[model samples]
Target: MAFLLFLLCLILVIFTVTTMGVPNIPSLDPVNRFLKGQTDVSKIVSSDFQEFFYDQTLDHFNYRPESYTTFQQRYYINYKWWGGASNNAPIFAYLGAESPIDDALWSIGFLPENAPRFNALLVYMEHRFYGQSNPVGSMEAPNMVDAMEKSLENPDTRGYFNSAQALADYAELLLYLKNQLQAHNSPIIVIGGSYGGMLASWFRLKYPHIALGALASSAPILYFENLTPPDGYYSVVTQDFKEASQNCYTTIKQSWDVIDQLATTPSGLAYLSQKFQTCSPLSNADELKNYLKSVYSNAAQYDAPPNYPTARICQGIDGASDATDILDRIFAGVVAYMPGMSCYVTSPEVVSPSESVSQTSIGWEWQTCSELLIPLGITSEDSMFQSLPYDANVFIDNCVRSFGVGPRPHWVTTYYGGQDIKLILSKFGSNIIFSNGLRDPYSIGGVLENISENIVAIKTTEGSHCLDILSSGEADPEWLVKQRKDEANIIDRWFAEYYRNFRLL
Candidate 1:
């Protein structure tokens, strides 16, 4: 009884010390500063382009406009004329996604490569609630915690962060830039990849007056439930590997069973930890499975030609009898995504886990919890993994816990008209290009066919997601090079038509 009492007291002391103490304030990390209410924009600088902020309205839908807040949204521009921004020139703008605007500008291929041909001004706009554009206002104000607490505590401020509001920001920013440059006639071509791609398409659909056209690559505009194939994402992942090597796919599919068995015993779990080089022991079956599955899904998504992971993954999996050897080879192949990272840690808390390759910004998570919920599940029937059905209830429960609000389940589909998306887009004019790679899982939900002469889908063989939009090189595939050339020609025609009609109007 005495020994038991002393043990209990010791456990209590450790728990109290760890949990009840004053919360350790995070150090001066960039991400931590953003989260901890440090919104000083002076420190966030970029050498590639001049950064500016536009004072944007909080809500465009509200008729009583006096009852809202306005905040500065960060954007970047590079004006060193490519071919010289002569009188009749176009503006190449990227409708930034849930990421830093500068990063997107530097990484995308089309704008840098083709902007010079049209003497276009390069502009990149950061999305709301992301990067330096927190809509609730500056975090660097005095009494930082109180300001953050007040914003969170307020009811009106909580629900203003959504896609519709973001499009309005883009429209306002577009007019601001055009007026500032004194080039109202210049045709504006908006470019984006992934979620940004979705925005690019929707922007052309909603506000065609401001945006002349859009280049939306890997944009899964039809990914909502009752619209896309339930197994589309995972099945495409399996197909990428199966095309690489059937034996590899078979080995990968069977390995999940082995992992499940290994998770059952202490010795087995320890072995998996050592073999996979996981930072810690496996905590549960689901976490281990998810980490394992992400390895293949990421490889499929980024599998461009020449340097992509298909050849490498197959080379590792072929004729490999030992399960440990197979896993090691697979892990080694996928680590190409993370260059400096040493070991694979399943815990998301780690700086760069294997799953971090697929991780998005914190703002994206909030958006998913608030409105955007695209379900990704895996099953042996659909992909090269054990059966794991997606549970919509699990998603709702998680969102409820995370955001303290339930998902507006069908708001996106209802507002946008999901099933009627193709028909709705048909009513619009041309200047919208939907580019997708066959290997890309998202392609399954994207626009794959030509709607009209103006609106068209350009499909690439053996191409991964958004390859047309990424940074290009001499090493790029012949198909991609041809595709970029075709896209540029289309844009040139669009600009010509826009200027021709503008003169008449």
Candidate 2:
């Protein structure tokens, strides 16, 4: 799917940590592209950008026999607005998250909408180990067996999937392209949202020469290594509803106990199954609880736009008749959030438009187990969900069980410098715009303040998830309009600085 005319934000950004430190939460189903306001992407043929594949090194940090191997990495390049190598136009590259990057060419609206003004060239790099970039094989490959999930299951092929390798892939590809196109003077600005946003920020931090700056929208760089509160994520989820209405918040907070009591007897379970429209008979409260958790948290995570005074979820609850039971009203909220569903299947749980192409991949699960150890959980004490804070022992056990390896929980901060963020960035980091919507749960771990004159944070209260980087709709709030405009201005300034510094060189 392609062609771009400032389309609506096509993908939501999700980096959620699953329960009990386990991974395998499914991503937003491809069948539900409409979940993110995309209506008919099937017919949107490629026009502005063309897909290309590069032979990328399998392992960048090793010299083993496997290191010599290469995989074809997919990328999209849109040159319609490029000023060409002679003019040294900025190249905007969106670092792929844990996703099939096929959709991202038109999925994100930021680059296309703003490219014409700067005469910028837009490039979207698919992350290694995901989608068609899979080192071992791809879904498109004939005899797809022993490929993708099957390939990752093989320890020999799986070890190469890591942040370092993926970032190196981006750097090498961009460097090669620059040389090939003779764009030695053009500055490369990396862009990403959510986990890809983390990669964007880390890319700038690690390879300043390669990436001039980064637009890290909703990047939770400090979520690891105890940089933020353990309960910060779910607390924000709770606050979103509490701000909506006290009754709605209380009903959600009390939902667990009600679900527990109802799950005890077969009669209760039958009633529960019928009420939530569960496809199967209720066996335990776990699935139902998880369903509710996903519903509320996702609603809060993607909670944005036009649903003023209260979100649609809250409206469902608050507008319900006083005679309605709490559970019925809760179901009303679920219906509002996910309309037109025949029934709710709690096993895999329902992934919303809010749960984007991040997470849920075997590669990402392995990353979480190995290095991207995002310690996320909720507690009924403060949050609306049950107590489930990060348990090191449990997380380690899960990691060991799944990947036959344990997580380097502190490696991210130790490698990226999160312990003393403001001080570290002030002294060394520059030209990185860390943008967030306070409504986003990930924003709790984001840089919300100016770290330095050049390394800055741009945020808005009304925004949610990757709102600032998405398409600017006519219904876009003044804050969102200003955010995109402001980001463009800052990017313009960064380009100027890069050109000035290059001239000095």
Candidate 3:
């Protein structure tokens, strides 16, 4: 699994528990409350925004040409007519990530900013099996166990939720939109960040005719074998903290030792539970370690504009009295992040038998188990934390137990042409902008250099994962402001070329 994507699931799970106020149930309708009409959507999005539900084929790759399952895929559209409404206006579409589409629309300001400039109708397409889009059934379930069982009970349904299939869904939706708006000549520009970025780039590869180009920000497309080193992800995480405050990094490493030493005795475990204010008792020492790792990983991954939580966390560590107190403050910060919520899960059964597991982990776990499976773990030398081997067998065992399917680790690389990716892009890809931040842990697994005249890569200095595409105003760092501007310029150029080529034809 891409550690960054895993962390996002973790964050969303916590967000749902703390803020969303969603009751535990077999199925949930997260969008109906917000989906009334254009007038209602205007309150959630901008005044011109309109919420929609388009029926999409459940399995785009289904061999049977005549029959298929269909679900009403949720999407939002804003035809603001920035440069006057016309069939020729391009479409700026967001390929939603593992998170909710509405969240992404609200959080990512770049899309809204650039849509008008391109004379584009803005669209945010929710990924199937996530957010309001549910293929097999509703997203909410009685529990994780039930969800897993139901997801894999029908092997055919399990086959439908992958990157390749999702790209096809995007293409189908684009065609549907073209027909609905009578904009067959309108060009489309796909935009995404993180896993969404990966989809955007792949969409260009698989369906270039549908999408003129893609703005893929901080996309870790090269995380597969023969493309990136296994240790690269965690090493970058360590560097982010070390850059902020080396003393804080050393303290975190030392605190792991303290945590391990304390976990040996029941009294020590009780003390930890009391100090950290864990939702449950400290039963599994390894789970505690995983929770701690997530703290650092989350801080580092989201260490960007608005509030630099990573820097604040490091400052807290530096300002603490001693090593033990340092650990206490760090845990306190985690608790503070989710105030008045029992967000941490103690049991192994619910959380996929690993510290990295979450309530939403099963959905992502199945994908990693089926494809896009990448090994990422902590180590003593490569990372600032204590050594912990990435147990591939454990992941396989859990996958088998949960989904009755084991991971095909090389499937993504094999299917997508791993190391030959550069060549693939050069020969076939164009009008794609791959943007990455130097501070981002996942940047190494992305396109850091320009591959060709059209397939461009923009690396940001002092920027975190997908920072350039995230919501930013005057408060953003100087570098990020400039990076966003550069990205916009490149996207404009791609649209220009697309129009030029279209006119020529």
Query: Model 2: per-residue lDDT, tens digit, 162-253?
Result: 78889999999999999988998889999998888889999999999899999998888888756877678788888888888888888778
Runs with alpha carbons beyond 4 Å of true place in candidate 2: 1-46, 139-146, 308-310, 349-361
The C-alpha RMSD of each candidate to the native structure, in angstroms, is: 11.1, 3.9, 7.1
lDDT of 3 at 100: 58
What TM-score would every model get versus the actual structure? 0.83, 0.90, 0.85
* Candidate 3 lDDT tens digits, 229-257: 66677788798888888777777777777
Model 2: worst 10 consecutive residues (lDDT sum): 25-34
Scored against the true structure, residue 147 in model 1 reaches a CA lDDT of 37
Off by over 4 Å in 1: 1-48, 63-67, 82-86, 136-158, 319-340, 349-359, 379-382
Ranking by TM-score: 2, 3, 1
Go through the candidates in order and give each one's C-alpha lDDT: 0.65, 0.74, 0.67
TM-score for candidate 3: 0.85
How many residue pairs collide in each prediction?
0, 0, 3
